[model samples]
Each structure stands twice: as structure tokens, then as C-alpha cells.
Target: MFQPRQMTKLLIAASKDHIEEVIGELYKRRLFHIEDYVRNEQEEWSGYSIGTSLTQADQISSELVKIRSIINNLEINEEQLPKADYTKQSELSKKIASDLPDIAARIEAILLKRSGLEAEQKDLEQKIETLNPFLAFQHPLEILSGYETISFLAGYGKGTPVLPSESELFTSPVRRGEAFNIVAVRSGQLAECERILLDAQFQKVVIPQEKGLASAAVERYQQQITGLQSEIKAIDQEFETIKKQQQLFFVSSEELLTAEIEQAAAPLRFATTEHAFVIEGFVPTNEAVSLVTSLQKATGDKIEIQELEILDLNEEPPVEFQNSRYAQPTEALIDLYVRPKYTEIDPSLFMAILYPLMFGFILGDVAYGTILLVVSLAARGFVKGSEMGTKLIQILRNCSVSAILFGIAYSEFLGTSLPWHPIWLSRHINMGGSASHGVEYVSHVPELLILSIWVGLFHITLARILGAKNASVMEHGEHRSKLMFAHIGWILVMWGIIIAIWSYFPLLLMPDLTGLPLIAGISSSALFGGILILIGIVFIARDNVLELMELPTIISNVLSYTRLVAVGLSSVAIALVTNYIAITMIIDPALKNFTAISIILLIAGIIVFLLGHTLNTALGLLGGGLHPLRLHYVEFFTKFYRGGGKIYNPFGMIRKYTEAEK
Candidate 1:
């Protein structure tokens, strides 16, 4: 539970004739994480170079591309398709490869035709828009453009100009509500005509050379647009029907070709001589025997498998975590920081426990917790198939349960106390002349702060212990140095300081200190703590004197945990204020008598209550989730973890859209 699974290095050698069989068997077992071979002139294995698998790889890849193209063109939805059988995948790929060209060509031809029709349709629509404004003019469009002796300019202006009808240079000004469509003909003095039009803010309009009235041209274009649209719709319906018939085949063929490509390209990672090949990888210790047996059977005992001991310090093996379902969600949190090194301890189990515990302490309210729990459960159901989404839901669900448990202890429901008596203490008791039937939570703030500090102390101590254990494993059979003793001495010094402070400074935070033997206990604890500190300094001094600089940091880290209490107190205060305004200012006045004003106040009060509580709940989630994660990542991980290991990735496919043979 605390460590990643054990792994062993595997080296396999086989004749060229049997190499393919060996690769296939290893891939089927899905036990090995292959290591690419590196050639060194000084080593005996240097004579062998990477094997040639490119020819087979290219053929398989080509088939895969064709299948994917077909599937994309058909717009197949994977969710609605039936799963393909793995046993029949080879036959399916071969069949599609042989028969696909004819059907695909037909579909391509129709699509090309549709594309041309769509372009024609767009052009026709643009022509209709350009012609609609000129429909009122009953002249041929060609005549407007082809006059050589008379200069005819058609344009729009803001208003109709007061044309001198007797003038020779300009004629025919027509107006319609801030828009003027006018034609100016100049037999001479074209510059004066242009000046008159420019004064009215005219914008020129170009008329196309068509030998018909503007309305007749627009009608002709509209008819062509309707014909093209009908043709495009017919082609689209045909394409849809073809897709419905061929989508399953295309999807299955793609899957088959992809798997084949992966299998055929496996030899690229191996080293090969003229007649033999060698491959190296890591396999889980438990799977070693079974893998060897399967490979031996598949290759008819021609392949040799050897388990090699890891002897190089620079060669780190890949890491694979094995955690229970309850602890698995914490893996996502841990990954956000860094993966634990192969030899380092796995901290997911510890994270699963402490993260929610801290979050619950900060957000102790039964009503908010219940809402969080429901939301998380609904999210889990909605995202059931997504790994990260499910893990996030699980983390939220765990925190919600913790919050509810702590809320019961605090006797709080959405920041106010219930009428029923608390198992421990209620925050509302004995406030401003109210009867003191039970103990109040406000008076216990000091105790909660002390408890937060104590939690930090315990958490850091566990980190040190785990760190020591990892050090022992990494430095197995080595002689212990003074650094080892220094590490142990620090743990003792921390505990000693905690004890001495609790005994001697009880008056600072403890409400009831009459039972403590102050003089005797404080004296003995202070002496023991002093001795422990001196011993730690002596041991650490032999390794490096600079480590003494970090002694003050230990105290600061522990004090940082006090935010748990501070944040929780803030939440409680906000909730109390929300309730006070709703009850005293709105609800109480409304209940005095039934009137329109009272009813309006009652609705306003309910709205305020809901909005305030909703906002408080959102803040609670942010603070509760983030602070615990900060404590873990920054303070806790620094002690025991030094993560930079690569994750394990074995060969073989876990097919989502296909079923395996029995």
C-alpha cells in the first residue's frame, strides 16, 4: 500500500525467424514496458542495430488512414454504433480494403457535384440582392452602361437634388425617404454634373451588363437558385443514406488497422544482428513467470528470456501505483504535484485520510454539507465513464461526509444552532442574556486553535518517519552515517518541544490548567527538551553545520496550520449574520400581521436567505478544498517525497469499441 509495485528487468533473445512470434506473445500478455536499445561500441551488444520494420509499418498505416478518412466523411457517431468483435477484425479490415474504393469514389463524385452547386447558389443569391434595389427602374441594365456619347452616372444620394430640368448636363432626379436613385446624363460639362452630385453626398452604384429589366434579371436568378438548392438537397439525402449503411464497417476497419500497425511496428524498439534479435524491457515481478511461459509456448522454445538484476544507480525503473478504490482518487491530487520515484513511498493513502479531515474541520455545517454531498453524487453519475471526473467527484463526496460528521459535533446547520441539543457544544448558547442551557462554541476557539497546531505536529512527524524509511531502503546495506542519527534526533526534538510547551505554557491557551502539576512537570520537560535539542545539533553538525539555519522554519510551518481555525471561524460568523438579517429585519416584522407590505417583505427575506447561504457555500468549497491541498503539497510533500519517475506504459490495447474473443 505504501510503495509502488516491484519490477524486474527482462531481456529476450531470439532468432530472426522467431522474433515476430516473441513480440506478439509479449504484446498479448501486456506485461512489459519496452526500453529502446542504445548502441555502444564498447559493449558486446553494440554489433546489433535497430531492426527494419518500416515496410510492414507503412502498409498497415496506409490502410489505417483510408479507413479513418472514410469514417470521418460519413460522420459516424461512435456512441450509437454497435461494438465490433476483435476476432473478426482482421477479416473486416481486409474486406473493407478490397471493397472500399468503388463505394468511396461514388460518394466523392456526388460530394464534388454538391460543392459546385453550393457555389452557384451563393453567387445567384448575391446577384438577387444587387438587383432588388434597381427593380423600380424599368430600363435595360445594358443600356445604362453602354452609352458612349452621353455620360450616364447612376448613384444614391441622401435626398433628391433640385435639378434644373432645363439644364443640358443633368436630368431625372428621383427620391424615396433619405434615399435618392438618380441618373445623370451629360452631353457636355461633365465636371459640373459630377460636382452637383458630389455636393449631395452621392455614392456610385455599378450596374451589370444584362439585356433585361432589373426585375426580370432578379426573377431569372431566383429560379436558378431554387433549382440548385433542390439538386443539393437530393445529393445530401443520398449521402446520408450511404453513411447509414457504411458507418459501422468504416469504424471497425479503422480499429483493426490501428492494432495491426502497432503489432507490426514492435520490432523497431529491438536490436537486431544479421540473424538474431535482442529486446529489453521491465515486467512486474508477479507476472514474470506467466510471461515467460506464454512466450516459450508461442515461440516453440526458440526464444530465451532472462531476468536481470538492476545494478546501475542511474537507471531508474518505471513506477506503477497499486491502490485500493478508496485511495485511488488521491492519485489525481498527488499527480498534480509530481509522481513518486520508483523507490520512494506512495503517499496516496495518507492523503486520502488527512485531506478530507482538514476540509471537514474548516467547513462544519450540516446543511451545506448535505448540499455538497448531493451535488457530488449527481456529478459522479453524470460523468461515470470519465476517470478524472469520477475521481474529482469521489474527493468531493469524501469531504462532504467529513463535513457532515463535524457539523454534528458543532451542532451547526448552515451556521446557526438547531433546537435539539448538541452532542458537544453549540455556538448560539449564552449570547447576550440568552439562557445558558449548554456549553457555547465561541468560548472554545482557543481549544480549536490548539487542536489545529497539534494536527500539524502529528502530520509532520509521520512525514519524517516515512522519509527515514525510504532513506533506509535506498541506502540498503550501507553503513549508517551521522546524518541518519541527525534525522532521528530532529524527530525527538520536535516531540520534546511540543511536550515542554504544553506543560509550561498551559495558561496561554488552556482554559482549565488547575489539574496540571505545573512546577515539577514543566521543569522536567524543559530539561529533557533542552537535552534533545543539543543532541540533535551535535549529530547534524557532523554532516553539515548549515542545517541549523532551518530550525526556525520548523516552528513557522507548524504555526501555519492555525489557518484551519481562522477560516472556520470566518465561515461561522458569515452564516450567523445572514440568519440575523433574515430573521430580525425581515421575517419578524412580516409575521406581525398579514398585509401587502408584509408579504413583500417575507418574499424578499426568503430571497436574501437563499442567496446569502448560496454564496457562503461557494466560499466554503473554495477555502476548504484549497487550504488542505496547500498543506499537503507544500508542507507535507517536502518531507518525504522526491518525485521524478516515469509512469509505466505496457504494450497492448484495452479496446473500448470492440469485444474480444472468448
Candidate 2:
């Protein structure tokens, strides 16, 4: 669809007595995009003010925080968790009151114990590392430091320092080539020991205070570390068991609490007086009547839902994409860039059409497309419950189909030509003679490059037309008319350049266009094209004289699409090289020889084949996806799209794990 869903403003006014019933009905329908009633944004009166949260808002929020902490501590992954059956709000609330506290306390206790053990294990390991240099020393650790009467330096030094006979010293080359020494003396001889060690360039290193033989201390720490590790491992296993048993409960409770808190806080967005409340929001035009009827039925006509005049909006209505199912997944792509303005065209439809088409055009290999198709299907389960991930997988599935269709036309299979000649174009029509490592080059690539340029021209022209329409709808009078003409000027400049090129260099990039009417005394299309360009400049000048500086941009934007062909050709070339090296150089030769060394070479070739194509496949997917996205965001959307519109998020949650009662 060209436009977002049509929306209408509504005023929901009701007695405070029916607030609960009215909010419930609204949530059930999930149609409204509520506007917050803040003093800064709305007219303030003596009695009218923002409503407070409903009863138990704090209690529900506190319970929800506990559930989230437990989930985080257990490392519960949403995708890996199984769904629970339909759970009523009453039932979930009861479970939260009865079961949540004990489970939270148990998990908290077990995790704290595990954390303590891990911390102890780390400390022991550090102590062992510090004592490693002294392991070979024929001395007890109790003699190392910790003495008030003794002064000592323990660290790396140049060599053993000469000290007073009353002082004691031990030195060893422990850290690479550096000497590690421990010098100790009675307090009376401390000054002499310090001077000698300082001359030796001693750099002190800290050591843990402990008692016993150095070897015995290290052995004791290692034992403690081993015991702590075992305890921690057991704790981890218990956690995994608890996660398995309680995942369904926690996941379901999280959703219910989250939704409950949302409803409890709904009043914060409403304006309330002494006994009445008013809620202002937008709903799809088609749903406005349904919403009113549904609320009346549920509240027994106690709640009032009126359709207000949709005029003089302080802010634009939230954009809800209205597109066919085939184009729906592309909405995620648009969201990554920016949501379209309600007044502008939704580019999802065009993106759904072109994004895959361009990707498929660039990666036209049947084997690679098939591989990608299988990958997307296999990965669907891994990324379950991720909406963006699912949408991306869906988009990839469509792109895979497109790639297969193009691959059929190109008659390519894993960088080699199929048995039959190309139905449309041969990416590998002429393989180059003997390349390095038995690799071959795809030389007949000019036609695809030329086709990419043509695609660019069409894509840019479409953008200009849409840009002009958007400018017309969003601007007024002189400004509107000027913008429309400027868009047309861009279109003309591109075509004029092509036509002029055709006159000067016939059949250079495109087909011959020699059958054009003559201009003035000359029979050259250049004269006619130059005239169009001059007139286009004048039309563009009416909008802004400075826009003429961007005239060359039309050429650059069109030229950018050439990546569609260039990236594909590079992929094709890699595939050919991979096949040639694996099959021709190693696989084929080894099969004939049939020896042990040949068998080893055969395995090596298989590795090369798999790894080379694996790398190429990743590169192809990246380039294929990013280049088209860039072209759309940078070249295509800049023409017509004025995004940054707020997304339509209704005041309700989509229950993924729970459902209605049967």
C-alpha cells in the first residue's frame, strides 16, 4: 500500500466508576495509540490533571522486578523456553502471590553461595600464582615477610646484593632472565640492606601473607581451588535443573505482570477530574466504530467513546504500516532506518519488491541460493520468539527464491555453467585461460554491468516521481509547485545525460537510440538532450538556485547501483576459483593416483572447497544485503521519504505465550 493505515482521533470519557471496565475493553481490542495528557502538552485547568496509577501498581511492579531478577540470574533464554498454555490474569496473580517469593529466595540463596565459592576459587588461584617462584626455594613461607623486627625487600633485582653478614638474603632467576630476591635484616641493619637492594635496582612485588612450606601452601591452595570448583559445578547443575522446572512459570508470570502493570499505569496518560476521566488517542478509521461498540457492550453503556474531529494535530498520528502480507516483513527494514511519516508514502512495499530483487540479481547461483534457503529454514528454530529475527529470516527466504529465479536465468551452479547455455545471460560465458592455482576468471561480465546501470536509472527515476508526489502532499502552493518541478528536473537531467551519451557514443552502454527526431539544423540527439537539461536547470532554479550544485549527484546515485553487478561478478569469480582448485588441481588428480599422499591431498582439497565457498557465501550475503539497503536508504529514500514518525504501539501487549480461555 502507498499510504499508512487511515486513522481517526477519539475521545474516551467516562465516570471514574467504570474506569476499570473501560480500560479492560480498550486493552482487549488493542486499537488505541494513546496520547499522554501531560501539563506541558495539554491545557491545564484547576480541577483537571494527569490521573494516578490504579490500585496495586507498586505491588505488581515489585513482583515483576523479582521475576526479572530470577530470570536474569538463571540465564533464562526466551527463544529456548517453551510456551505455557492460556493463563488467566487471576490465576497468574495467585501464582505470583503464592509461588514467587519462595522461588525468588531459593534462587537468590543458591546464586549467592555459588558466587562466594567462585570468588574464593579466584583468590586461591592468585595466591598459587604468586607463590610459584618460591616453590623451589628450600624455605618455609612463614619466613617470607610479616615480621616487625625484620625488614625485607621481595622482588626482581639485577643480582644478589652484598649485605651485612647479620642480614639474610636469597636470590633466584625466576622471571625470565631477571633475578628475584628476598633480603631480610634486623631493624638495626635495615638501612644497610635497603641501600644495597636499591643499588641492585630492586622492584618490589606484593605477596600473600601465609604460613608453612612454600610448596605446602601452594599444594593446599590448589586443593581448596579444586574443591570450590566442584562445589560451583554442582551449584550450576542445580541452577540448570531449577531453570528447566520453573522457566514456564517465570516466563508466563513475566508477561502477565508486565501487562498488568501497563494497565495499572494507564491512567497516567489520561486527564481526570473529581468524578470523570478523559482519554484521547487515535485508532484505525475502520476500527473506530468497532471500538465504540465493543466498549458499550462490555461496560453496559456506562463508558462513552466518541469519534472527535481529526484536525489540528499537535503531533502527527503514529504510523501503522498497511501493506500486503508479502510486504510486511520489509517493515522491519524500514524500522531500522526510520518509520515513514504519516503524510508520506510507506516505502516497505517498494523495498519488499526491490531489496530481494537486487540481492538475487547479485547472487545468481543456484547452489548458493539453495544453500541460503536451507540455512534460513534451519535457523528459524534457533531464532524463535525474536520478532526482528523472524522477519529477517522471512525476508531472506523471499530473497532466496528470487536468487533461484535469477540463477535459472544465468544458468549458473556453484560458479560453473550449467549443462545448458544461459537462458538470459551467462555469467561464466568465457572462462579465462589457466589462472593461478587452477582458478578461472569470468570475463564476459560487461553485459551485467550495463544492465545494473539501467536498473539504477529506473530506480532513481521512480524515486524522483515519488518524491514529487510526497512534496505535493506535504507542502503547499508555491513551495509545493516548486518542489514538484525540481523533482521533474532531476529525472530529466538523468535521461538527458543518457540521451546525450547515446547521440555521442551509440551503443556504448545501452541499445542504439538513433531513431530520434532532429533538433534545429543538427540531426544529433545531443542537441535535444542539452535543451532538456537547460530547461530542467531553470525549473530546478525556481525551487533553489543552490540545488544546481547537486546536479552531478544524479549521475553518482545511478552509478552506485553498479555494485549490484560488480559484487555478483566477484562472487562468481570466487566460486569458479574454488571449484577449479578443489576439483581440477587436487580432487581430480588425487582420484587418478589413489595413493596415501593423494588421499591426504583429497581431504585438503575438500577443506579448501568448503572453506573457500563458506567465506564467499558470507561475503556475498553481507554485500548483497548491505549494498541494496544503502542504495534504498541513501539514494532512494532521500528523494521522497521524510521519516522519524512515531510508531503505533497500542496500550496493550501481544500475548505470545498465553491465550484466551476456551
Candidate 3:
């Protein structure tokens, strides 16, 4: 655990193949690309590509095709992207990209039929509208023959004088073909004319009648319109079927291309000096040697490798940003629960230590701990799916083993009292006196509080050490001093108190300890030491009086961990209360059945008990999880690490639906 691992950043100049190899290795190491900077020595490169140089140029070409497709299908009133000189060709390129043999054939078939069918259908519809007015025209003969005559007024005029007739009206300047002839009427009079004719060349004509002759011509037009409409419907259905087929063809073709493109583009290629090649990525410190050797052998000594300065030998780097493929299993588990606070802290290492500690202290129930371990091991070993969740589960499983170990010491099982409890329980009992219940005695709760405080002290000390380690890497001497003195001073204070308590208390079962007061005198010494430590912290941080107010803040932060004791006590108390209620229900003689029924009702109340306590436990964990991180991020990170460094990304095919080649 004390061994130091060296970290180094390497920069390499090599042929495209060698660079590709480096990127592939980094990717396998779980180091994701964050950004890429490509330099085109000549103006030949367009968009994200580096001219015609790299093997992955086709990937850029494909993206361009996608951009063009969006431009081509753009809706009216939508903002068009700024037009480059190649708008027309770009649209055409996308169309061709989207083209497929089966779809092209289907589109052709639909277009050939749709064009003629739509035109003919439109003409027929217009003819039907022209004929509809005749449906209102009525014949007087039908009324005389006991049929109800449907008489209607038809209007037509354009700058011609019209004379009214009872049945129809005729306008002046009428042409021969434009004449309105009444089929029949009750009387023929100038007042009876139902149609007005507008003449050609200002010539006027009038017919005195009570009926119109356009009905037969209109009926004949309607018949022809109806026939045309039926034909249009048949053609439309055929077009719809062809369109669906075309859509299927295009969709399937896209799926196939997406699957194949990455595999097809993996070969290495070359270009002239006009395009400067870039190979940038991360490599593990261990793998750096073999990679350098491989590059020398492959390219015959034309490569340049530049190693950047590595920081923070003592501190762990952030899990998300780590380039190591070989992080321990525990660290892998924690990565799922929390993102790293900085690039300097290794999540893997923190998880390795923290998991066991949390389980040992918080759970501390052998039976429950055993269950948790078994469940976790089963999930890790048997379950091959849910890779992320599985990793975290496996870590928790191992951590739970510590709980089992501590539980054996405490001799606890779900808070039930054990008469033959182990040596650990005896030690706690020696420290804090037992509780008596007239006929029986129970465990001590205050002792648990003291135990919790010690656990907190230990954990806090570890965190400070981690902080100091990071401080050394970042070249911040002040932070190193603050963490060093603060943690040691606190530990010294705690040790003095523990010694004083053990020696002074007579029932603690110790040898003659008359000089206990001298040991207790260390309390004053510890206090003075703490003040000095605080002075050192202020000096290193250069905190003003206002910042010193953060002392209260730090105390509040540390005190928040007391909830661990609060939650555990609450869980046990509620369970014990349940037992009391059950005993009352059985013993009450006057209303025994009523009491039993009331207890049954209380069984419904158990849901509230479960949920309320669960919520409390969750709150404790949340506060615990977040506060520690807050200390690390705000208090610790401020001491060292300025994490604004640029991340390394590369040129490659980036798609939402498809994976890219290395």
C-alpha cells in the first residue's frame, strides 16, 4: 500500500500506423478521447478532415453527406445554413449517398405512375365542379306532371346588358354557342326567360322561356368526372405501396452501411508533407517502455517521444480521467457511484480502502454482513450482464467481508443481545458500563458513539494524508504542511483522551493506575498543539479572519458524521418498540382479542416504520457521501491541483448510432 507509482505523460511523433497503434492501446486502457486538433499544412483539407491524407478521410466524407441530406430536406420558413459555393453539389452528393438499388427502382415506379395519374385526376375534378351548377336547374314540365320542380337561379355576366324573363334572363351581346334554350315552360314571355346570354362583340340576344337546357350537358360531364375519380383512387393506392417499398429499401441500406463502415476504414494510409500528421493520446507508465521499443522497431528510428511532467505521486488521480486499464476491482466499483473530484485522485485506490472501512464501521452485523457478501459475490461471479452495476456490486461484496470481521468482534446480529458475545464486545463493555432492566441488562449506546468518533477520526486522517499526497504533486508546500499538522494534532488529542479515560476508570479492569492524572494532563498539551495546528493551517491557506469562520464550517462538517450513530440507534430502537407492542397485545387480559387486532393494525403501521427509517438511513449516507467530497473539492482541491489542462482527442468517425474504429 505504501509503494509509489510513477506517472509520466508522453508525446510521440511517428508514422500514421504507429500513431494509430498508440491511440488503439490508449482506447483499450479506457482513456476516452476528449478533443482533437488537426493541422493542415496546405489549404486542401475541408471541414474536420486533414486533406486526402489519413485512412479515415472517408469518415469525414460520410459526415459531409449527412450534412447535405439535412440541407436538402430543409422545410420552408426554416433557417437555411449559410450557403457555401458547393450547395447544389452538396445536395446531390447526399442524394446519391442516400440512394440504393431497390429504393431507386421503387421510387422510379411510383414517380412514373404518380405524375400522369395526378394530372388527369386534377382535370377530371375541375370538370365535375363545372357541371355541379346544373344540379340546381329545374324543368317546369316535371311540376306539371306531378313531379316537384327544383327551380334555381343561375348567374353569369361580364359587361353585358341583361333583360329579365320569368323563367330565365338573357344578357345583351350574346354569341351563337352561348345561347340559353329553355327545354319547356308553362308560358313563353319576355318576363319568363330563365337564362341571360352575354353576346360576343357587344351583340345582345334574349330568349323568353321558363326552363334551362344546360342540365343534360352537365349530367354527361358529371358521369365522365366520376369515372376519372375512381381511376385516380386506384393509381394513388399503387403510388403509396411503391413509396413504402422505397422507404424500406433506404432504411435497410442505411443499417447495413452503418454496421460495415468502421470495419472497412481501419487500414493505414499516407499523404505528402502538405498534411502534418498528429498522433496524441495517453499510455500507462508501465506500458510506455514496450510501446517505445515497438515504435523504434517498426519505423526504424524516425520517431520522436516527448514525456510531459507528471504531478502528484502521493495522491490518486480522478477515476474518470485515468488511463489505466488495470485499476483494482474495488476502484472500478466506486467509479459507478461517484465521479472523481479531480484528475489527481485515483478513484480505484480510494475505493479499495473506503469500501472495506464503510462496511466495517456502518454495517458491523455478522449475519447481515454475511448476507451482503454472499449476494455481492454471487452477482460478481454469476451475473455476466450489467457490467457497470456488476462491478460496483462486486466491490460492495468484498467490503462487506470487513463488516463480518467487525461483527464477530462485536458479537452482534441485527441488534439482538448475545450473552456469549466475543472479546470486542467485552472491550466496549469495559469502556462504558452496562444498562440494567431489573431482570436483565442490555448493550451500551454511548460507547457506540465514542467508537463512531474514533472511526471518524481514522477516516478523516486518511483523507488528509491523501490530500497531502496531492499537495506534494502539485508543488504546493503550504497545503502539505496544513494537512500534516492538522491530522497529527487531532490524532494526538484523541490519543491523550483515550489513555486518560482507560487509566482513570476503576471498573475498566486495569493494574494499579495512580498516575492517571499525569496522563490526563496531556489534555492541555493536546489543546495547545491543536491551536498550533490551526495556526499552521491558517498560515498555509493564507486565510483571513473571515475565512477563519470556516472553522465552524469544518466542525459542522465533521460533526455531521454523528448521524451514523443516530441512524443505527434509530433502526434498533424502532425494532425494539415493535417487540414491546407485540408483548402488550399478548398479555392484556381484559381486551386480549381487541389488543391483538390493534397490533394487526399496527402491522400496517410497520410500512411507515420501514419507510421512515429507510429514508433516514438514505439521508445519512447522502450527507456522508457528499460532505466528504465537498471537503476534498473545496478544502483540499483549493490547496493544490489546478485542473484546467486540455484533454487529448483525435480525428475519427463520430456517430450517434454507430461505433468507430480505433
Model 3 misplacement above 4 A? 1-10, 14-35, 38-275, 293-351, 370-387, 404-409, 422-440, 476-547, 581-662
Q: What lDDT would candidate 1 get against the real structure?
A: 0.76
Cα lDDT of model 2 by residue, 478-580, tens digit? 8999999999998888888888878766663585757766667554688878888888898899999999999989888988998998889888888878887
Global lDDT of model 3: 0.45
Better of 1 and 3 by lDDT: 1
Q: Is candidate 2 or candidate 3 better by lDDT?
A: 2
TM-score to native of every candidate shown: 0.85, 0.85, 0.50
Ranking by TM-score: 1, 2, 3
Writing each residue's lDDT as its tens digit, candidate 1 over 1-662 gives 88888888989999999876777777667789998877767677767898878457887787677667767777887877765545465566557667877776787798789889999899989888777667777777776665556666666777666554533322334554445364645557566767877898878776666778989998899999989989988998998898888777777667666766788888888899999989888898898888988888988888888988787522367888878889999998988888888887899999999999999899988998999999999887787677878888899999999999888878888777656556543444233443222324454666677878878888888887777776676654433445466667667767666665654666444333334544555565566667777777776666578978878777888888988888887887777667667766688779887688998899998988898899899999999999999999888888767788778888777665444331
Off by over 4 Å in 2: 41-47, 107-158, 167-187, 198-241, 312-315, 429-447, 508-520, 524-527, 579-609, 658-662
Q: Give the Cα error of residue 582 in candidate 3, in Å.
A: 5.3
- Enumerate clash totals for all models, in the order shown: 0, 0, 30
True-structure lDDT of candidate 2: 0.84
Q: Which candidate number maximizes lDDT?
A: 2
